[model samples]
Target: MFDGPSSRREFMKAAVAVGGASALSACMSRAEEPIPKGTDDPSSLPERQHAWNDVLVHDDAGNVEGPRHQLLLYVNLDHDGPPTEDDRRVLESALTTLDRAYERSHEGLVYSIAYSPAYFDRFDESLPDDLDLPEPRSLAPFEDPEFDRQDALLHLGSTRADALLEAEEALTGDRDTANTVTMESPLTDVLAVDSRRTGFVGAGMPAERQDVAGIPDSKPVPEQSPLFMGFKAGFAQNQATEDYVTLQDGPFAGGTTKHVANIRQRLDDWYVEQDFEDRVAEMFSPRHAAEGLVDGVGDNLGDSSGLTPDIIESIEEQAKQYGRVGHAQKAARANRDEEGNVRVLRRHFESTDDDVASLHFPSLQTGISVFEEVREAMNGTDLTSNPAIRQRVNNGILEYIFVRRRGNFLVPPRRLRSFPTPTGE
Candidate 1:
């Protein structure tokens, strides 16, 4: 966001201050690197209890870009090699790219997050944007604006010790080596930062609910959303190749077509899966109308009937909450560079799962309709036990149809994949 950094170290420090790293370099993209806390070891999965946040980084800038995090996610293509210097270089490059995206002139800085595995090595092997990109640039890893507000310069270089510690944490996830280090917030006692310090932050706070002026008329702001852009580009450009990605021996100097192709193929598949969520996000917030739900919150309530507008507004408000707080920390990590590449290197996420939660379809429509009906049933009445309407709505839906949590509607299908077709059919 500020003038291009003069030095790598300086840029690294500044990038953290903004919204972490870009999706390109040794940073995370708009995708959050999954942070499964409560365990010192990242590889082991514990029963759900501790919080899980997807905090990832990406490098948006292409490989030609001199300043890169160079994240080498693998120790050996074969499961036995230890992490090589090349691995560190690739990771560092990825971090730098993620920071750059976070430091954009527009979009200020925000965080993006998704469900990533506990281990970095197991990150989905997709380009940050999901494209078979020639070489990815870095963008911030976060996807939500709220988390971006709280996160700051990762300063991986300065916190050399901490980065190493995180690496150690990554290596073993062992409780015996649970010691860690992290930066204190700038908002801390260092110097109290009021709204004034945060230019344009509260300019629309009180009236902010009603003023989604910056919000696009397009439903979920995915295309317009920086998070969407970074991911789309990453996914779209990434091409998948055989296990050993090899391109024809070209004259691209040091360019091994093989590695590029292998990673690209996987990235392409990963990006497609990631887009599933983005498309859904857009469906619910198709226009500024949902965006205006926040605005509606600040507006004067006229009745208690809980009519269409009110209920819709409530839904929008709740959806916005998901973007704002529910996944703040995770989104912030997604906005960083380190987190972005992690997605590129890793490839084991629920995005490709067959669980009930993965069953997204027309049932969402039923859910939404049911939700509205519930609101209508509650209109001027104590709907605490309105089982008739509740059951009516439930019966209205097809079991195969997918609905959102607590929502009584069917989800819209964005593509054929939404159907329960068998693999390789």
Candidate 2:
């Protein structure tokens, strides 16, 4: 079904979204070059599982570029209660096989495994007092999103479609080996995959897949936009450094908390009713639209969104005057700490899973409360006092985006990634 006149990248994206053994075989047949091999020494890898910036490619503007294709495997422990040492060894062997099979880079494979609060509850001991992992819940009053209480979340990302598919097959026991590396064990020996989601992010990717349901038939997604919203995001200046989000003094000190949300996008009104200027106003800030600060897909902004403190401070006045505030503007109010450091690192990607337009949002921070605080600011509940800004209508992109699912997890240090206990056994 992915066959057509589409570019190779586009075809690979389609294959990933419709993943299976057949898709993997077709992807392998289309490979133009051999994938880079991984290291035999697992000790050489970063201690933090979320560490990927050093090896990832960056744009000319110095902004970090995420992998082209991504996959999420939400799995549950095959048996109830705490896991046994044998289970831990089985999972570790399966993961280490992946480490030896593929290079830990965007061109190869960069992945992380995180445990949910539900998974830790099975253990008698509780998490460290300093750690702040929490159960997922709705952040806003208007939305009712399903909570993901799975035992663990395994995130895999790579530029090569075949690499992602082969790694997944190896973990699920579908294949005996990945990249010619024999698998000592498969993850299914200890855990069963409860859900699988796929997504992509890169220039020209969103435009090629705009035929989905939530997007309008006009195909208004920009060819240069990495996201379906026709704009660039993840500005380096606006993002928190990995060190800031990592737990500094706990057993999981080298780790961090991750809040993952699946958001469904309805772009009919976003693209159909609004023009370029209107979108710029709602996406960035009204001042940006008036001063012509943003260009096509916002590549001209460089490493920043150009949201100055004054622009963020004038949100109320802008709402009263322009009758609209921006998505970035509202979120910026609480994104910064008292010392002016960014609080969360957002690693979001667009998706066409289930033939619908959606986004897989992964945010890393020191704690789940920090993410909740930033999300509350994004909700723009306080901005409703301006009368022009209702809960969703003129408050930002809320009108076009709906939260579908939310989950929180503790990304332990690499040493404890395999079915770790709450106390880091």
Candidate No. with top lDDT: 2
- Alpha-carbon TM-score of each model against the true structure: 0.19, 0.98
lDDT of each: 0.21, 0.92
Off by over 4 Å in 1: 1-85, 101-109, 112-115, 118-386, 389-425
Candidate 2, which segments miss by more than 4 Å at Cα?
A: 1-7
Candidate 2 lDDT over residue span 155-251, tens digit each = 9999889999999998999889899999879999999999999999989899999999899999899999999999989999999998899888868
Model 2 clash pairs are: none
List clash counts for every candidate, in order.
177, 0
Model 1 per-residue lDDT tens digits across residues 224-309: 22221111112211211111121122211111111110100112222343344432232222222233321222122121111233
